[model samples]
Target: MDAIILQVLNGLDKGGAYALIALGLTLVFGTLGVVNFAHGALFMLGAFCAVTFKKIITLEQIVLSKTELSPWGTPLEIRTPYAQQWFGDFGNVLIEYSVPFSLLLAIPVMLFIGIAMERGIIKHFYKRPHAEQILVTFGLAIVLQEIVKAFFGANPNPQPIPQIFMGAADLGVMVGMAENVITYPKWRLVYLFFSLGVIAAVFAFLRFTTFGLVVRAGMSDRETVSMLGINIDKRFTIMFGIAAVVAGLAGVMYTPILPPDYTLGMDFLVLSFIVVVVGGMGSLPGAVLAGFMLGVVQSLASMTEVKDIIPGIDQIIIYLIAVIILLVRPRGLLGKRGVMEN
Candidate 1:
């Protein structure tokens, strides 16, 4: 029972990430009817945004102290004690307090990147066939990845949990498991709740607001929305930005768990697609539910007994489930008949 509980918690964390990314993918596919193969790149960009912000936060202006004379009588330059104290000892010391600060810095930058991609690149491919769109987006993804590599290098960067959130909490007492407390990392728990809050806010915005209504109506029927003089194109561009921000924010919070890496976004791309498909494209509730469901299933597959019974079971579990779901329901669990039809 204790083990099962722990597995459940692990699954929720993984699900949170999958759900967030899948939600963005669904938005693009549902709203624009554009198969955004580059979305994983956006996710990658979001994760790298954390790395960029962290780098910027830790940057220090280099100042030279001219207290000593050189051999040619020029003053010698050395770093000041203040610099050492502020930055820490030795080579390439960081501010040690920059990870959290990255959150704010990453948002606007990511927003702009999202808008730029939508307006500059994605805009041109709207009317193209799915094959062309996929080819271009895939090519764009490679270009984006290469760009990130050029700027940030190819190595994975470390993103540690803040000093304050370095430990785990025991939740056994709350659940009547006095001797079997559920241990959870503080940062991860925070991320789980934060993700939930963001998702709720997104749903609420869409559910109660006119803007959301228009967007939903557009998703359901784009021509009608345009006929109603809603400037559907503009709204969709904004929606693209919103989707980017969501993925970026997910990347921002996910840094502590996986750390920010150039390839991190691509690593989860296939799984995210599966989640969207299984949830039924354009079905927000289904996306959310499937994200958590698959997350839990994948986590459970990691058990030692399960591993012993079937080698590589953990990895294929989610994909297997997706296959089963698709086979069972051609339109996916909650997909509409004409949602993705030509």
Candidate 2:
């Protein structure tokens, strides 16, 4: 029973990330009818944003000290972060929580990148063939990855979680299991709640606000929204920015759990697409539901006994389920008839 609980927790942790990325992908595809292969790059950029902020916060200048000297040197050179010189305790705390603070930095940066991509490149491909869109965007994704590799290198860069949430919480005691029988990372728990809050906020923005109502209406019937003088083109562009922010934020929050490399975006891209397909393209609820469901399925499939029986079931569990779902419901679990049928 305790093992089951642990597996469920792990699944939810992985599922939250899948749902977040898939939600953003569905948004762009559903809203603009453009196939964006570069969405995952935006996610990678978000992780790098955190890295950049950390570098900036810890910028150090060498200073020669008169009183201190090295064994073989005439004078000692001291390195100190500018933040430390400018602000003492607060700066330390800021660096200590840089992962969370990166959210603020990521929002504006992602918005700019998204708008730029939309206006400069994606804008021209709106009415083009999906193949063309995919080719161009995939090229863009590769370019972004190469740029990151050039600057940050191809190796994974680790980001620190806040000291406050570093250790594991004993769920065993809290849930009436044997003492120390179940433990999970506190940061993972924080991440789960944070993801839920972000998802809820996004849905509320789309469902309860006028901007969202207009956007939803546009998604359903763009000609009518435009005919009504809603300027949905501009709104859709903004929605693109929002989608980028969504992906970026997910990447930002994920750095502590998964150290990011240049290829990180490509790694999640296919899996997120699979989630979107299984959830029913353009279906937000379906994406979220499928994400969690697949997560649990994956967790169960990864058990040693199951793997022993099936021999690599864990590796193909998601794809297997996706195949099964698509076979049964061709349009996806909750997909509307007209969506992506062409």
Candidate 3:
């Protein structure tokens, strides 16, 4: 029972990430009517932001003082692989100092990349067919992934958890468990709560704010909204930007859990699409619910007993459930009656 509960908790954390990514994907598809195959790449870009930030902050030169010991206790001086591989001697300087500090410089730069993608590439595809959009976006995704590889290499680089979150918290006492039991990493807990808060804020924004109202209206009928003197196109662009930021932030925090790599986006992209479909196309609330549910199911499917009963259960459970759901509720749990009627 305790193990089950623990798995449930873990699943919730995974679900949170899926929910965020799927939310963004659904938003773009539901509102813009564009099948954004490059969405996964945007998520990857977000993780890269953290990597970039860490790299930037650690880029300072380490000049050993005449009479002082280095942080390593000796007159320590060594070149980092980054310098040796790329800049030659420059990367060595950064290893001597903090890397996470680079985040201050990495975020805005990433946001600019997001905007540039929207304006330079995605902007022209608004009126194209779904197949064309998907093909082009998929190509764009490949291009982006390759570019990242060109700069950072194809390796899954580790991004260390912040110093403040270096250890696990004792959740046993809080949850009435035995000693030496029920512990979780502080960084993961923080990320879980942070994700929840962001999800709530997004929902609140869409539910209560005028901008959200406009966005929602635009989603339902851009032509009608445009008739009312609102610039739906610009708003759509902003929405795209918002979606990028959401995916990016998801990627950012996720880096500590799963190392950031150019290929990491591919790992989540297919599952995110499944999540969106299971959640019901265009239903944000459904996406959140389905994400967490599938997360649990996927986690449970990994159990020894379950896997023994059904080999490869971990790989098939989510899709199997999705198939059942589709058979039962073709439109999805919370999908509108005529969402795809138009």
**Quick one: best lDDT, which candidate?**
2
Q: Which regions of candidate 2 fall more than 4 Å away from where they truly are?
A: 68-77
TM-score of each: 0.88, 0.95, 0.87
After superposition on all CA atoms, how large is the RMSD of candidate 2? Answer: 1.7
- Per-prediction CA RMSD (Å): 4.7, 1.7, 5.1
lDDT of 2 by residue, 144-262 (tens): 99999999988899999899899999988996777888899999998888889889999999999999999999999999999998899999999999999999999999999999999
lDDT of each: 0.81, 0.90, 0.79
Candidate 3 error regions (>4 Å): 64-107
The better candidate by lDDT, 1 or 2, is: 2
Model 1 lDDT tens row, 212-304: 999999988889889988898998888888888888888888887886666776787888989998999888888888888899899999998
lDDT of 3 by residue, 1-342 (tens): 767776787788898899888888888887777778788888898888778767764555555566767777887564335444575565444443233334444456556766687789878888887789889888998898999999999898788776667798878879787875777787778778867877898889888999999999998888999999999888777777777777877888788889888987877888888898888888888888888888888998888878899899898898998888788887677777777523
Ranking by lDDT: 2, 1, 3
Spell out the clash pairs found in candidate 3. 53-102, 53-103, 57-102, 58-94, 80-92
Go through the candidates in order and give the clash count of each.
0, 0, 5
Candidates, ranked, TM-score: 2, 1, 3
Name every residue pair that clashes in candidate 1.
none
Error of 1 at 210 (Å): 1.5
* Backbone clashes (count) for model 3: 5
lDDT of 2: 0.90
